[model samples]
Target: MAEWRDPQWEYFAIQSLRGKSFGDEWPTIPEFFQYTVERFPDNSAFTTFAGEQRESISYRELAQYVEALARSLQNLGLTAGDRVAVSGKNSPYWGIVYLAVLCAGCVVVPLDARQNGEFHKHLAEFTEAKAVFMDGDLLAKLEEAETEQPAYRKYLIQSRKDFADATGAKWETMWQMIESRKGDTTGALSSLAQIRSDDMAALLTTSGTTGNEKLAMLSHANFTSNLIQCVYPGLQEILSTDRLYLLLPMHHCYPMTAVFLEGISHGSELIFPRGLAVQQILQDLKDGKVTVFMGVPMLFNKIIQGVLNKVKAQPAAKQLMFRLMMGISGVSDRMGKAIGSKLFSGVLKAMGFDHIRILICGAGVLMPEVGEKYRRLGLNFIQGYGLTEAAPIVTLNPAGTSEVRSVGRLLPMITGRLESSPELSAPVVSVRGHEVGELCIDGPNKMSGYYKNPQATAEAFTEDGFLRTGDMGYFDRNGYFYITGRSKNVIVTAGGKNIYPEEIEELFQLCSWFEQVMVRGYREDGTEKTELVVYPKLSEDCVARIAADRDAFLSGDTVKDPAKQEEIIGVQLHREILADVQRISRKLPDYQRIGRVRVILLSLEMTTTQKIKRFLAESRFAQHNDGLLTESQDF
Candidate 1:
């Protein structure tokens, strides 16, 4: 099959060992899992914090546990076509339970643990789940939901010590059930009989980049195709002995597919972090000897800032030497990987990333400058583009062939198109250089539909069946995709020109003072105007210096001088920030230019993947309109 296909997909049955097949006869997820278990039975499959102790489970052991749990669920009178929901943070037990549910031929629903109680209840009821396996802390919400929506027959609690009291009478500890079964694999083969390749395997909720969220009904074939078509080709160079560090929540499709599932399929050791604290992550990186590090842009930005801060604290001569070394590394990277990898080993090892061979970035747009910096530093950092709807991977930059600015080439067996709208009559998309448009995808990995919501499912696709990805992007001549922004987020000026806030924000990423930036339009006299809100992360030493100077002045000491006042320091900092904003604003158009800028002292609320909740901040700006800069009402 060609990489790109027509709008009306031609489906064919795929061949497989299990006698089950999808379009063109492809093997399903269970078949793939069977293959992996047989291939790497003795390898360590997963590791995570169990209570205060770190627990490691081998592939063979994990397979046995999954089978036993499947048997237990079957014995409880749960049928093959039932819905089971799993809500929690990433853990080895979560992985085992997820696979076990699928092995029993039930559709798995992985909910975002961070969602509000109302949204969580709505989704559980929407999916019509028969059973739920949740982190014990969230049991109360489910119990409340059962009162209004009584479909669920059981609730299984994850045994975290703090949440023991939250469990209900219907609850059973996941690990306890598996332990009692004692590796019984009696009905494992028979359970596989009930599963079909095209049946819904998992229901992953969309990130809700727009207003509301919907569940994508992905099949065993959908996920398995993604594993083979997207993940395998990108990881061709990565070895089975490599260790992949899993930091983000595993329920997220990016980490679930790229890090967790890929590691299991490739026989790599997956090391789960105890938490997201930088200090803890650093220790885990050193202790686990993690060879593959994957994360979102925000986490990488923090790590880079931390490294630079440490470098700045060193003496003048050391700083000069480091800069010279970085220059050499940049030159080597421009030359190619063979030269760069060998030349930058010393610097990379000093930064504690020596063992890391690949760094996969996803979730949100990774700044090009950051990608370039890591490339020069000898870590093969590459961007991956996908969503939960496509089993989360459609494209990944191949090592050695990657470009800094682009998000890499499309993966095998995937087809993409761009349109002005979701309608079939919508114009064919084009771009000036790397300009973007609404990105659409069609492939074997594409989802079946939004689960149980026919209206939403119908709205999510074009008449010709292309998945309408609310994301806007354009592809270069080299087939490298560059995401500009979301269609809903584009700021339109009075002149009718569209501007992406992310483009403007990317320009400010290199600025040292600004910690976070969000650009939006404010309404004035029924007209829209652009504004920028910035959260400045001041240097700790600078804050201390200002505090000391203020304290000394207030003490009425004769030694205190007005020239060294805290107010003076504040004025100087403000001037520097104004200059930086002006420099960036020059690149933007007149209407799109920032009119109001505010420097916030506190960090903004962010998602688990580190994307700022724009709607929350937008509402805050409206509530405190007095703090913002505004033009005259006449304008």
Candidate 2:
């Protein structure tokens, strides 16, 4: 075939690798890593902050470690295309094992570190993983289980001597494996030549809590193409000097591809925070001089709220000055100049966000107000939209030209269209000049298919080969995309109008008291109407305010009876939150207005990725009676 040049793949760093390690197609993950090592041998690759000290590794040193581990894995009977699962917290060791699995020509399955042993066992058995590298605590859990364990070989991610001394089990550790094979020449590097860009590099499960987990098979081309699409043509700019922060779990594709792989491909230093603690993150941000930070919407909201709460505590004159500076910053940013950082230099330094150059949000929706606030603070805040099925990055809002209302512009070489018909399982209708429909994408970034599930794979794509994203959305006139909600969460009213729960849920974000909220269809007088289930933040002040509102009911008998006090608070909270919802829903069409509300004292269950598990919440609502509102209490 004649050499094909894709403008997207022509990113200078990728272009430098062409005709060498990479061909006309994208390079395998290992190949790209090697290219980076060769280009920036002395550059710091990975660093982990551990309390008072930090551990760092250079690109060359990381490559050496990866190759040694790869040789050891090959010697341990794992060959090309074999499955190996790695489960651990975010650390340099986890990164080494992940790269080593690919270097050994095996498919790396990065398991969620937060999942229990049973879930790990299910995943191992499903993927037929021949070997597993896991944290010591997780390995112990797997062994202590009374049920039969999977027959795969296990290697501890901890020290061999420590784990053996603690558990009296003689399992080799990753470091031991590497030490035993040090300086021993193996054909692992030679065999890596056989790996192609189309080969599967990673097998990621989209849904694992359910027994029917859909494993998305992503090829080398899928991820590398995504990296190219995101880095070039003004999507996101990253340089070798940039230090990327890794706070989220590495098993999730968002952090894996966006921060880890993208950082390595550009020879940028990746800082692994000690933990997700707010103080620890702030310290790491300041100490590591992190330039790029990526997180979920919940984390961003909490940070922004923290900043605002502190600002509100300042004297009236200082608060007014802050507001004036913010207005000036917003005006300057809109006119192609940004002076917010310079104006709020001291404030940024105090908040630990002084060194941050770019803030990216993914894996959930970010309120427009949050994005605007960050930009007003002279920070580059942008969000992208993607799922595990699409190698996880479909569109990224370019910095400086960001649109707060839209997710982002579609990446180069990626084609997207909306389908509104019987073919699409969801009902999509025209709304506000843009036809709301299922967003289908076609590009190199799309996954190969669901592994081992031919029927599910067949249903995931359209006849012309666009991956059906299962997200109902529309594109604005300026080529920006807006996602309303998931197709499965759509609510149909008696009037035959479609209401997306996500659209309704977004309205609740402005309510600071709501820690979490979910919108769903409920039966009201034999008609389906929208109902909101809110888990409010019971802060000291919030509780005092609630008590003040129900002063008449909380006297004598009610005050003495705990159950009665609880009941009164729940009822009054329902009314207050419902009133706010009514005020907000008035802007929407009549059919979409919320007709009922439920206030639950307990917080809603959240996934490891910080997403509300709607189905799980519904299951709990059906099974439990604590604080759950009955259908008879409809407004």
Candidate 3:
């Protein structure tokens, strides 16, 4: 096995002497959960928004539930090392099922429930899941799935509704199975306790940004090592007393490792949103006394917009006070910890982040402007970079002393180096600071391989056994990593200059009118030419002005005027957006400029985390080709 080294581990070891350690070996999810239970049995584990009706399960109670579930699973004739799949939204039940399967000595396969039929079929078949636990909406698809998927043995429904027909396939509702085995099953618990740390715990799938998604095989040690890495580093700041507000989908590796597993390990209370609504999230943050806020760039953007809008509407004196306080806070944040002195605490409290000590942005690149604003507002906004394959954490900005543009220093026990790629001659292979290349990693957090796909597993690693991240980035002199773009997404112009759509898109994010943007090279004749497609979320004021102008024109109020009263406001807004794009592109080479742009009136399709689906947008742009702005055509 390749050895992995991350420098942060030693720092964590020195600071967090009292916390539990899994040693150099990784523990299975069940083992970690058990360890936490043994250490903090009385601490509150999870909470939800249905009334103040909190489900305060102590570590001991959580362990018993896991044992009970494991016993029930065992009674169903599931042997050790079998694959059990679970698909659903984030909930306490989801967490319980994940750990129970591990305790039962079975490999857990977590599937994203929002996936389409093709993705669902691919994932289920890829893992060879023996049994599947799914929600009601997904159960219908499972019925059809069994005909195509012969390896699946059972379908356990998570909802209350009964299966309309279950003649051919074996099906059981979650509640029914648990109720039937309500009596204590201590013997099964003893059987579970015999499992080892090296046992396989999960088969987490990659995001498949470049091609088809592959299942990354992870043992108990992989996840356990990652959990310890996060907890031990900032034990003093990130403690059990802090309330973690979890809004990101728990199925993804980043949130799974950073928020869910970390919270469970530390015995901190986790507050789930009532739903995905932004208003609900704001209300939850305030009411739940949330101390830790972990979210994606889109979520943070929306929250910032909400706060800014409020600031804009305030009285002149209040606005002046807020701006002055923000400036003071910014200086403090830059000059190290002692400067701000909580001068803007009242402003932050009003904006619903009073108790929030750490606001972590992961899953994608966060705009620096947003990061700076949060810092100025007295929030500890930090960015982390990793993939699903790395047990999801390779680099994270430490709570304090984080550089604005850097993704913090390299994590402990992880060795990173940039060298020339033997496969690709042009682009370099990134190792250490500032030189861009394909980011490669070899670490404990790295996945074993793609499950059941030896060909893909072999392709994932380089000749030297480093995991090819497919992401392009470089380390700065200070060891903070700055990602440029994906290697595959780089646009090579006719002039041979490389352009990254993400860099151009980041510029558009500064435009308040636009919500999302995707810049890509499309075929113009036989040559590839670049085009910009922007999804603008027009402000209410803009919308109303357009509506009023239309109303006036329709009423013939301006008929007598020879001036073309065409809704020039919309056109003017588009021009302003184009100008902003041009201003940012001045920093880039000529080939990467905004040669053409398409201002979308409707919102662009996006994932749950608010990442614009590039292919989808490309397809939509192609369908409306005539309306698009292009260099060949006049603006």
Candidate 4:
């Protein structure tokens, strides 16, 4: 391994001691993980649940697996700096392959499982991946999409019974590597390929290629610096315990670095559920005794909402006690006394959060109301803000120094500057004179550049050398950052006031009736008006009543004509949903009030990170109707 030091010595010199040592600053990703292994060789390292099988591996065992895989790849005529692709659901095997590829001095390409096969193919060719490791489903998809045989070597995550490709061929299995090296592994586990700190560690695709590849290229130094920055008073505060809940997909940068690799850095075990199936997640929490849980906005929104709904269904006396405890807990939280653990201890245990210490939500916007509920219920709730280009982490809510509304302060040794986005006309929206500009950051953790796309790379950074994050935000008197909305997502009113649809959308998010809501401005009769597109989620009571009415109609006990009854039910549900939205949305100012509404039956499409893809949704609505808002009725 190369002994790399910070090129910008002057900048690193003033940083706090928190980031001093990480087995040396120039450590490779494999070396860093190995360092943790040396610290806790006998500790439980990884655990995963898949269907009927449950597996656990120790740090020492995991190191041997990585070495075995690297040796296998070496025997196959591959050397350092080769590219390998791994695709599968979140499992311990996926993680093992990911680390093993790096251990062999190969750059890993992690593709999103939700993406299409053609996109995946394009990523493989763009990165020139020499080999691919995939599960049965992905292998089938790859086979169907290709007319000619692919040149890359193939490996399987798990063996498929009697499975054959187009040529009736069987691929090698990942488990074989472990079996071959079970014993009599002397020279195999001893030496590793020489890796430099500046070598490319991974290539992460941001979007579909348009003939110009725009994969975010991160270096070994980039990964190491971020790991050190995070370990030193970074995530180490939350991940100090032994076990962490790996909830999100490993392909996404947030989970890959912040949760997965962060856990390895601290010798904390990871729990990967069978799949993201609802019941599986609950069961995994119970079985794994997860200590740190990291997720996005949707995860916490549903979990917290589920617990609250259960509380409401309790008997009157029990409900009264729960409410009283919650009230007292809220008061105690304000006074810096964490009493929710004792007050709502039963609620926590019931939800399988008996061992949960910290709950970190990132990758999407988290509604403040949901965050407050968790905090009041005695969970340490945190919100983070970042983009893929920054190796995906720029700012996270500090454990003890967190603020309710802010996204916490910038990471230590990371510099954030607010650059004027006069084009968006986001007029310093604060009265206290804080500049509201596109949040641009400068840090060693930032990516080198977009892969082979100089035009895109040039546009990503400013002349002054900060990566322009294209996110419109402002900073408080303290160094904490606040994101208002994306630059392209902002809507300007005729009155020349900047209106962030996210702000208006957040107000409606407080109500569960609207499953998905988006606020956008449309021109109608030469006037720009605010419009809301909604997908309704029926209340439990309303759904039950509707089902009961349908059953009575079917039995011919309530209505003479079933079709008319169905029509009436649909109309009633629409009215109920509209009324609920109107009641909740009235809290917004007159200017921010929605002037029109469009109700779609289907839910809006979201990104892998669970963010609603706004432009695509608008296009979908436009394709189906002449106007996005069919009914220009305002409430």
Query: How close is each model in CA RMSD to the real structure?
Result: 6.6, 5.0, 6.3, 6.3
Candidate 2 residue pairs in clash (backbone atoms < 3 Å): none
Which of candidates 3 and 4 is the stronger one according to lDDT? Answer: 4
TM for every model, in the order presented, reads: 0.85, 0.90, 0.84, 0.87
- When 1 and 2 are scored with lDDT, the better candidate is 2
* Cα lDDT of model 3 by residue, 331-369, tens digit: 777777634437867767776788888888877887788
Instruction: Write the residue-wise lDDT of candidate 1 on 515-607 in tens digits.
Output: 788787766667666777776666787556545654442232422333333243355665566678888787765766887665544445666
Worst 10 residues of 2 by lDDT: 551-560
Name the candidate that leads on lDDT. Answer: 2
Q: Which whole-number lDDT from 0 to 100 does residue 408 have in model 2?
A: 92
Model 2 deviation from native, Cα RMSD in Å: 5.0
User: Residue-wise lDDT of candidate 2 within 1-635, one digit each (tens)?
Assistant: 02224455445556675786677467888878877887798999998765778778898878877888888898888888999999998888889899989988999998988878887888888899999999988887767752764678998886324544564456778877777776874323424537888889899988432235688999888998888778854667888999999899998888899999999988999999877877788888888989999998888888888788898999999999999999999899888898888998887887788988889988877788788888989888998999888888998998776467688978877899987644333344677878888899999989989988999999899998999988888998888998888777778778778888888777677676678888878786788788778777776764665556443322232333435534645556655666676677778788887776666655666766788878777776676543434333223
Quantify all predictions' global Cα lDDT against the true fold: 0.71, 0.79, 0.69, 0.72
Whole-model alpha-carbon lDDT for candidate 1: 0.71
Return the TM-score for candidate 2, rounded to 2 decimals: 0.90
User: How much is 590 displaced in model 3, in angstroms?
Assistant: 3.5
State in Å the error of residue 297, model 4: 0.5
RMSD (CA, Å), candidate 3 to true, equals: 6.3
Off by over 4 Å in 3: 1-24, 51-55, 117-122, 144-171, 185-194, 232-237, 338-341, 421-433, 523-529, 538-576, 586-591, 601-605, 615-627, 630-635
Report the lDDT tens digits of candidate 4 across residue range 1-635. 12224443322432332243232345668766776787777888888765657678888888877777777777677788888988988887788899889878889999888767786677777788899898767877877777787778778886322232234346678767656654633433323777777889998876331123368999877766676665434333634356888878888888888888878877889888766765677778878888888887777777877787787889999889888888888888888887888877877787778788777888767778778888888888778887778877888886743355777777766888877776464455652367677888888789889887889999999998899887877888777777787777777677766777777776665555667788888887776678887766755664566466554433333433334433543666666667866776677777777787766544667766676777677776565542123353445
